[model samples]
Target: MRMLTYISVLFLAVLTVGCGGVSLPKEDIFSCEGFEIYPDSIVRGNRIYRAVSPREISNAWTLPDSTTVAPEFISTLPMADALFAKAVISPSFLTPEEIWLSLGFLRPEESMQALRSLAWLPENDNEDFPYSTLSPYWAAAAWEVYCATGSRTWLREAYDALTRMLSRQWKLNRSALSEFYCGIPRGVTEQSTFYPASMDEMSRFQTFSASVNIMRAYSLRIASRMAGELKLYAEREWEMEADKLAGAVNDCLWLPDLQRYGQYLYGDYYPIVSSVTDNEANLLAALTGTATPEMSAAMVGELPLIASGVPSVYPYVVNQTPLRPVVQALYGLSAAKVRNPRAFIHSMASVWNLSLDANYPSLWPSLVMKGLFGIETTPSGLEFRPMVPEVFGGEKQLRGLRYRDAVLDISLNGTGDRIASFMVDSVSTDSHSLPAGMKGHHKVVITLSGNDLNAKPLRIFEPVTVPPTPEVKWPTANDMKIVGHDRLLHYDIYLDGVMTQSISTDNYHVRPGECGVVTVVPTLERGSSGYATPPHVCLPDDEVISIHASSITPRRPPLHFIKDPATATNYIELAARHNTRITCYVNVAVEGDYFITVGYSNGSERCGIRTLGVNGVDVATLLFPPRRLNDWVHVYPSTTSVIHLNEGVNKLWLTYVGGTILFNKLTLLKRS
Candidate 1:
């Protein structure tokens, strides 16, 4: 692989590929602007390319390509590398997640952001969106923001906002599964709660989600601490409430034998982990203090991972990327020299043909300030204990990091947690901290002993039990009405294998027109019920037709090979390599009317992402995770997505963002 520089103020085109597979950059480097590069410096890979800064150097962040900020850094770290800066810093680059992550480095007001899905909201109303993003992680994110800023004013405001939020929007949802508790509902997923069903998102399934509840529990604990510091009266109440939820999480969801929490639970005490892989719920359980120390220790000994990055879920219902796992688990596992998240990201992008930026900038700063550097600010003072992973086995430096009224320049040599020497302004200090009242620019240097951290090894990535792919049972034609189990159970209605509606026994409905092949998968509070559905024509109450891949394909039965869009006008074709700025047409109907699935093959190590367009507008970034190809003879993987269709014919365009894909066919299911 070689570096091919495409000079642009905001974009840096860095491609890495070899005959064997994806090749990583020779070195992971994010250097300070003051670091000089000669007119033509030699590098690896034949030393054929000239090394030059992509932009002018400044006292601010020196990296030539990323956002120019007040801080300066020269890092050769793995996760917290040069590309981290490029994720988001400029207002134009702001994303919902990035704004939360930016609080450590940028001003709070500058980082205030609205949901990308809700970007249509009015500008004046944008400021309020942060408080109402419908996520269980809000309180924890606010705590991190305060940790980075050390602002009492922000803390007080955050505390007040959380109080009101808990009373109103942030309160736990009522649950039927647990008779005594209300908690974060199932499918609360990530920070956002709504999207066109593209990846079997948890949001599409409403149940009791352990990950969500654990976050809610953690938030309450943080809120309680904040209240005590501020002398608020609700500290005890919130703490007790947090304890209640945390207890419920362990009692109901913890899979003791598996050493992890189940993904979710049904209303009547059925855990859904029988056929599911453990995910963020466990990380949240361990990190949030929701789990006991014993439970956490057990988790450290177990927890499996995907072939590349740690996946969100295994035997994926759809394409998945382990973004949360990387952010929350990697640093926690620094003692074990766990896999680097950046390597997975690059490898995934190499297959997806898209380099994602501005989505996770804050994660880098969080991992650095709170994980590797281990900077914690309290009323007493500030403590700094670097816990660099073995992957970052070298010296790294950061300049102009603002905390309170001080601008700090810190350098760490060697890696791991063993500290050999600590010095502030060339003056050695016995303690690894600074006075709270100390307010001045200072240079601090630290050296590691290069010995073991003495910390318990974080032995994640242990093999988890893989349950059988429970058989899917489709509703028979004998009944238009769906029935639940004699015991408490529910049903998931799938249109063309894409789940559309989940109905409980009490509120079953059979809407005849707004569906395709009708199959009802019986969902128990405990185990899997393999379900099936078949293609059935519904008279177009609104001119809707059940669409097959044949609607746009020239062949039937067997999925025809997708030729280049340039030549195959009638067949379903996507853009191939050497063809940028190309748009291919797969005119289906309008959205809110169809669920789409694609049959594909990916033998790479990492997950790939592709954009799905509704009409001509891009609605979702779909993931295509790696599967065993056995040279295209083994697995023919498939993923489902929702596409709304109009009353008449609608042109759904799948743009060739980049890279070549092995997608063969598109399956459309009519959706409500």
Candidate 2:
């Protein structure tokens, strides 16, 4: 009987895996190849790159070349929304004495500390609880990731946190629970009382939108699944409670007239009332079943009208209404409506383009492709579950959907009967046999900016000395004195002794280091006259070194190196006691050897160039063992294999690796 049961289960698994005689081969939905990128696409890419810098894209787009490539626009969701969410809550809860704790803002260890503190709150007799501000949003996001992946560890952590949150919620405001006022938990300790400066005006009822009810719902959904897996009664209770809360929310917040849920409280005097146009409310309404399918469809259909500003004077405006576009694409494509599905897609594309225009970045493209294009993967190979629109125009070609260590590119036929190609890490190739005739969306997620083989190196500072002072040139011990105004004291100034230049001023505005530079010609020759020198070099103790200037007046205005170029090389020279960094606009040509040189000369010694590259890309170069040259250096890309160079302008950046070095010029070029 046991053997028969095992066989039955296995058969069921197979049946579920291959249902309706339709099988989907794995494919990537986020493809950048066919899109008509504008001529200034590079600038948009730069914006995305900078917005999510230092995090390195890791989800939905890892390729075999050891590179993590995230769609610049698509990767911003995780970067910005996540950041905004965290920023909103960090001030209140991530503090000591809070019963319900977090890892303290963005730091995981700090969160652990808060959690541990909450676990042992009995010992800390402090009166005010902190972290109530951000708890719900953080927990909701955490629960979201766990649900999306079904990861056990995340579920476990989330369960523990929920347990603590429930305990605190029950303790602080038991009446709130009964009144259906489950929002941000109140502070039990004094330390956590100060909410964000912006939220000073928010009423207590408005706090649930911070994280409460939504996270509880998501958490309950996951707990239910986990309980089934582990046969845990607590999980069952959570699931029931989640459903109860969902029903309560529907009853309290649903607005049938507006086809959306209200933000925070339901009544008109409740501070944050429902903006009939708010997208989040619509999404919550649909997810919580507050809005009927027909209503949901209406909300989706009205997206084009809202976004195009048909009812209002403005068009293509985005301020605090995320639901207008995301929900339109997410649920619009999924819902069954008389309107062409492609119209929803077009609407989504237009909104996404608007976001780009306004300089917003996120993993939006990936979400659209996954939700609308329906390209997902399962345990039994891969799945291509596309939501084919009647007006889809034709087939769509997509490349670079990636997993932990796999890359899958796919091409879909309009009729959904064709399989174009499959490559994992640009090496393993396979011919896919996709079983045809399917009509359901698959769940395949590709990580963004992940698995980039030619990954750029971290920006590091390298220091190079400009004036290599030898032991012989050093003054004897008896002659050494700490001079207050020594002529050789300027760290980043470039001037040869033979130049016969002397510069000084009163305590007025642009007096030397204050901002502007003062240049003057003295009566001395380039080699200098007698031993004392003639250019009026200031001694260390001299308050001011008076020099015969053609004229003496403050500079027209102070200049910032970042705003205007002071050097001829276009390289902004920065003074540093340790290392210096310079940034320019330049593209790497090949994937091989690259060098960054800093040149300097006091009309004598030359500062040699330093080479730095990873996989032949000039991500960064550091010159070690600082030598003084005070001359121009060429930072070039040298390689065994040729890398493509784009036509037009590029910025080149240089930094001192270690020990200060003066940079006179900076350049980006292909090695000869």
Candidate 3:
């Protein structure tokens, strides 16, 4: 009976493989599990792209609460990259007509009802479209969509829209020396220097940017291709125009000193070569085939400057603004993958780490499919030329990949393996090519048995060293009492009466066996005004620590406490109309029973109510009785409250409930 059962199972396995029935792996090929942060999803017409939230309005010094404001619209570069990602994972989500329509909406005259908040309107509130520096990208995006879905109607419509926009709005400047149009808008290049995207602030004001010119050249080539596909009469004109621009960029922008294109052109004549190199421009030059072999090699050599896994200016110096931009990183990494896979993999890992820290959107999976897998959708069919990096382990298979109208299950066996034998639909072939214009589910089995995979990993970037800032001294605390100096900084209570941790509020409870030499440390530096040394004290296990509200740090709104003329002491004024809240950081070395005491003064005739919260959780409501006019004496309302605290960092917050109240200090006493 056992022999019969084994024989039956063996036959079933052979039957499944022979019949082109492929099984999917239990694990997803690109899973975000165990990652510190995952990219946020943006959905458009059933297609999703992992996108980073737009820069918070508050980051720009805008006063409106960010929580209430809608996130800014996705920019051109990120949107293009997202489209690419969508095409790779779910090709059906992107249609050439839809992509063209979306790009059209970017025009100011179009009805914004479809785009809503995603439309970019100029600050002047005029109907004039904000001139986009990235106008060429729309043409490139349309070309990609056309390549994925061969729709003549869609291509024609895209061609019309692109020609109208570029001819009327983005008119090329014809140079007297050359027949090619060499001019871009005056401020087109300025858009590249947006903060946290690129660090070319020094060249932000330059009228002519080398990178923008390269992109223009690339966009023209794509437009010419699309025109040829449609048999349009303007095909030759587009091609000639593209050729002229490419020639002019090489003639004017190329710098002998750096052996690469200069950052930008000053006054459209003098090429201003700065110390900083723009990686995005060089990468674009390589992708567009405008860079010479020597120039491409030089660009590859500078990969080390992209230390943060994304392209920032080379030889990154601290305190310099406009850090790494996600768009440059995505494009730069993609360009490097084909020329240098090892460097590409290393940078991918580094960028992944940064994404985790910043919660930035990622294009990793898309790059993996397009660059590593080398999947290109040609007019003929899906082309597969996988370039596996040495860092990749053994056999890998990507299943459930949607290509056009077909669902493909592709498996690659072994690392550093070339296609020894290729089988499509159980047919053996010497050439690893799939039939063009085939629809429906397809099974592809690739067997690779070549040289052993190279196990060594390449380190492409240098270590970044951060400069040290001035140290801040915190208030002192004894086992019996704790005193704070700055209301903007939090304190930690350490063992043995040594201030080990900082607490923001008096809401934390003390645990047993937490007593020792107590020490108080400030979480943030008060800059030059900070203490020369931290304050410390020794106290019994059941001693109490008192913290003044003035010692806690205030994070966002820029205001300082007002000094009392009589006492010569500072106190925070709550009379401002803006919403205000104070946070205190406290560390408890050991958890135990603790009591909290809040000192507040309300001089108004009406009683004031303030909400008390510990570690983001509302714990109690304290009321301040009306005091005599002009009275500023501190009073502890509703006796000290007992609350439990864990053995770690504790945050306490005092939020204004109603009425004006002046906070003085908080006291935390350990219970025996």
Candidate 4:
């Protein structure tokens, strides 16, 4: 009877495989000839080759060539986006409390840390929470990492942090509309200057931003997924909250006339006016499943705005090409996956070409794996539901993909829009799912046929590496002493003349018996075109040595002396009272006349006056003129003053005379 039962099960299994209902292990299922070669060509020798995009140049810092995967038939935009997302993992600019995914070419970690800081600051006892703008989509970025790496450890860590952040956000920012959340007050938002919403600068008070709420819902859904993996009961609450938020967004934020969601709703200020239509918000709605199928279709219909490429905003905000819209647009495209794959491919290619022309490294490659390849993480395992455009013919392969404990190498042979057959390893399979608990290397090859199929894969040439000019020179010990006025980009510090540490600071302290050589590099050269005025640097011939005043201890006062995370430097602020003063003790290595340049910001209408004194002797009354209100990340150069410093420790005093000013660092440069 037992033998009969085993035979019956065996028969069922064979029957299922024969009927194409179950996969059967087979030897040599298909040929690999059609797939494109991956790890797209990279220039070998480098002075820092200007790759087609900025991130491509920077990608060498993290992703070595051996680990990179280049899939053929993938256009440059999606390729660049994938590379940028991989490169964005860095230490948080704020407290290195946690790793963060950066927003863009600027400080990338700040993109998510800003939001985390805002949400967790009030709840945590830690006083040193770095001040950054609030971002609601941090979890979404984290989810990308989880999907790519398949690290349960990373997922758990991210899950805990996001849960705490969500709880705090609920407590502080949640709207009276139940699961809905309000936007940060404009004053606070302006201070951070990093919210993803499109409110006019004049928009007063807090309102419910559709983007933020959708982001919250998206994050909750991700958290719920993570919780379920850990078998945590809290997953129910997260799912419940996500459902409620989505419903609220549809019920309250949807705009009937536009057939899209409104940008924001005036919080409790009735008859609510929802005037603006944000391209990014609508895209997010589609990407996160907040939008209905009809809404998704309507949003996808706006692909015409990309005449040649995608714009940051539709209806064109003058001089605005924010990264959010581009990213969101790609997400929308991936989510919609409309029937006209050829049009989408053409539009994406156009955007890629445009990005190359502009030298902007947009993160478009994210669309390749997530959209075109249609790779998704299921509880069972990784699922591949590719949406290959018929235009991209021949064979395309994605190699060297790291997923948890496995390495996935995927190959697709396309003759047309549809995949005729697919093979997993040596096994013949028609299933879309790769069952869970897959270990080691796995390969999936899909074959398609149509009239438009090309015989060869599309090829993009590797960037040419231009050698540095003969005049280009590394800084010597003498050059290190000359402080350039441009923002200190980084420092290569050597101990006993051997490279030891690399830091982003103008100041360093040498311990006893340890000789140190510090080289400071600036963000731009003197002739760079961004600023109107050339930066003031000590002449190459100047007999100068700079002491980083920020490194010195300042005498306590009524004002706060805080480290500005944006620059990773200390600055003093909030000294509005009379008779307030900050004193820094500086050790002068040489006795000579020096120019004392204080980095500060005076944004108010009135000028800030301060008395500069050397060892209690008043030297000059320094005047800081009012400049336009700038982002807090900026530190402008103050007018330089000549002062004599005796060898050994010299006391420098900034006596408060009036007005408001943010004092960054003080640099003492010896005169020629």
Number of the predicted model whose TM-score against the real structure is largest: 1
* Clashes per candidate (backbone, < 3 Å): 22, 90, 49, 17
Model 3 Cα shift for residue 628 (angstroms): 53
Q: Candidate 3's residue-wise lDDT over 1-672, tens digit each?
A: 334333433443354357564322222112221221112322222222233223221111112243321112122223222333332222123322223322221111221222222222232211111223335446655665555556566677767766755554332231122223323333233443321122222223223557667777877787788788888878889888888878877887776655666554432112222323456666667766777766775555544343335444443333433445343444434444334655555445444434332423224443445555555555556666665654444555555555546667776654443667788878877767665566898877767654553323433444332221113232333223333344565545444323345565532334435533333333443211111122122345346565665476552221332244433233444443643577787777668655565666656655454556776687654444445555655553322345556678888776765566566677675543
- TM-score order, best first, reads 1, 4, 3, 2
lDDT (CA) per prediction: 0.48, 0.33, 0.46, 0.49
Judged by whole-model lDDT over C-alpha atoms, candidate 2 comes out at 0.33
Writing each residue's lDDT as its tens digit, candidate 4 over 1-672 gives: 334433433554465457554422221111111111112212112211123232353234334455533332333322444343343333334322111121221232343345345445553221111111235556766655455445677677778888876764552332222455554422132321222233322122235667777877888998898898789998999899899989988998886665667656542212142434555677677767888777776655533233333433333323334333254335335342543354355444443433332322223344455556666655567776666555344566566655556667887666454657778886888786676677899988877655342222222222111111011123542333323422423343433223455545444454434432222212223211110111123234333444443554552221333344534344556256533787777777788766666777655555565777887687755545455664333566554456778899988788875667777677666554
For candidate 1, the 10 contiguous residues with the lowest summed lDDT are 30-39
Report the alpha-carbon TM-score of model 2 versus the true structure. Answer: 0.37
Cα lDDT of model 1 by residue, 146-208, tens digit: 655566887787787677656543312322123222233433355221211222322223245
Candidates 2 and 4 compared: the better one by lDDT is: 4
Model 4 TM-score on a 0 to 1 scale: 0.48
lDDT value, residue 185 of candidate 3: 34
lDDT score, candidate 4, position 387: 65
Sequence-dependent TM-score of model 1:
0.53
Residue range 1-672, candidate 2, lDDT tens digits: 334433433443354356442211122111121121121111122122112222222221112344333311222123322222222222334433121111221233444545445444452211212123234334434433343334466557766665655554432221221324333433212212212112222123323341245444654665565555556787767777777777766665555564445444321111122222324344444543445677665554443243221111011122222223333333333332323353344444343444432322222333344433454332123344344433332434444433323433444434221223333333323433222222233222221111112212211112111121111111431122222333443211212222222333111122243221111221122211111111111223232111111121211211232234343333323334322433444444343222233333221132222223323354432322222233233322111111233444343443443232333433232322
